[model samples]
Target: MMRSLGKQTVRTHYQHIVAGVHDPEHDHTHETRQTVYERPDGTFQINYMSGKRFVMATNDGSFECVHVVQTVRSASGSTIMSVIAGAQSLAVNRLNAVIEFESGDRWIEIEDDETARLAAGLTQTAVGHFYHEEERLEGRHLRRWFVLVGPSEDLAVVGKVALFVLPPHETSVDPEVVDCHIAGYRNGNPYPEFAAEIEALAAATDLPITPNYMGDPVVTPPATGRTPGL
Candidate 1:
């Protein structure tokens, strides 16, 4: 009865028992955080903590060229949220940026000087990109302000702003904007010092001055996390 271990198979499993194969759970780590919540129907909801990365697609309804970290299902053996390092867009990253922001609270004062400087540069760059469009009478100044805030700066400000590009579906934080604002307050920035520029430039045009107000609240980041010494 020991004739053979042969044949109807997806591949030659015995022959192709090699490293770096197509095993989805191969690199899965034990560090992945999982939390279970009991529903009224006695069904359990599980939250799987995974890092952010770009995803081309998934069998689930979530389909995007970017990695998506969502609390959708409670399946313990569900697919891991894998993300590509150095992914292009932070807005679409599959990371728990809010958690990172909360973790970063311990270092806020130390980081923002540099973070703010970078944000200021992006702010200046955005101003240039919208110059021609501003002449076309398009307003969304806050949206324009958000263009290059990156994960640290702008994306954290997503839900707290009057004009937010992304929806408020997940728990997140924008360290860049808040940090930069803090840096500006501690140091100096033409953003607030010369905020009147936006108002002046917008008076004869349709640009909004609300983005000018973005500075004040930024110094005091939202109650998104544990803001140390504040």
Candidate 2:
């Protein structure tokens, strides 16, 4: 599952490893690789890194070792459309929204009254103001949509979709965190990049996209399918 504050609170243990080697067969020549565990804390401490290359041989076979360390987070909010709508109510105008998809494309939707209202009240309280907070009120016109993703029954892929919501954003970022290691993978591996795309898209709009782990977005033109009115 994607790391979020909510999940971290309930289940705090997590481990991920990404390794790149020149040859798989040669790398696994040894019957076992050394495993070490040290001081466990909220932070990840890199125990070591190998600067020299060395070989080893037991009764087993010729072997080698590499040392490394990395950090991980176990934590997790918000909608863009409502913020746009609230901005409109605050007499802010000329807003545009760009939602980058998990696939390398974007779905752009123009906001109307209803859509703007959906997006408006979704903004957080501490951030309760565009210009200022004391004047804040809900039910402003704004546009909004949602994406829910989880493991599929088959367990090979993640399930995801984009849907419109009638309510304002009700979610909050989680506070829990855990240490983790991320392995390098193929280009298709979704990680930091998906989150990065959203950051770029947010720049196009007057709205602010929180820096969360939805990963980087793949921006493209807006979706082409029929969409319900805002």
Candidate 3:
């Protein structure tokens, strides 16, 4: 069975670790202490990035999925959302969704069990703002998608990645957060690449291709197809 979050109030814990290796992304291996939080909710979200970078790991409970994020930040100051919807490249099975929403509600809806599993099974876990907290309305206006993953899952493969989609004119920069790491980002979708995995998931789901909700339109998903899950 999968673990999930309940209605109880919770607090995050902090930890520090040191290792000897080279990080291609940052060109460094040493890491600063970071905070980690596990929402008992079925999403299996694992906040494991170092305090220097804003990243996340997630579990896709409802669909047998997993995801990660190398959260990007915006150079400009604005309320934005980086939504995921398609695959990155044809060589891998990861989905890529790095879309920016500056002024409207967004959603990453799963239409069926197959799609849910596909969405959950990808690599990482993250959220977007097509359904973020905006204006005076509550968070309900912004629809978000959650997936299931476990603590023991290995991310050595091309697990799905959640990239932040930055504005066309802005440069993506690493965040300078201190103390507690952040789960939210404004740059853009962390993964903007595409893959066959997305095409398979779309075939097994029921959300409309060109969808609209809360006076805003969602990004078009990959073309649909039949896969093992369906």
The lDDT of each candidate is 0.25, 0.27, 0.26
Which model is ahead, 1 or 2, in terms of lDDT? 2
CA-only RMSD, every prediction? 20.6, 19.7, 18.8
CA lDDT, candidate 2, residue 136: 27
Predicted structure 2: lDDT: 0.27
Compared with the true structure, what per-residue lDDT tens digits does model 3 show for residues 1-230? Answer: 43333221112222212133322442211111223334445233323221222224425222111122243334553212221222311212333232212211112333233434343334322222211211113322222242221112222122232211222333323242111111111111221222233333233343222222111233553444432221
* Superposition TM-score, candidate 3 onto the true structure: 0.24
Task: List runs of model 1 lying over 4 Å from the truth.
Answer: 1-192, 211-230
lDDT of 3: 0.26
Candidate 1 positional error at 111, Å: 29
TM-scores, in order shown?
A: 0.18, 0.21, 0.24
Ranking by TM-score: 3, 2, 1
Task: For candidate 1, report its TM-score.
Answer: 0.18
TM-score, structure 2 vs. true: 0.21
Off by over 4 Å in 3: 1-17, 20-137, 141-194, 209-230
lDDT of model 1 at position 153: 51
Candidate 2 local Cα displacement, residue 167, angstroms: 17
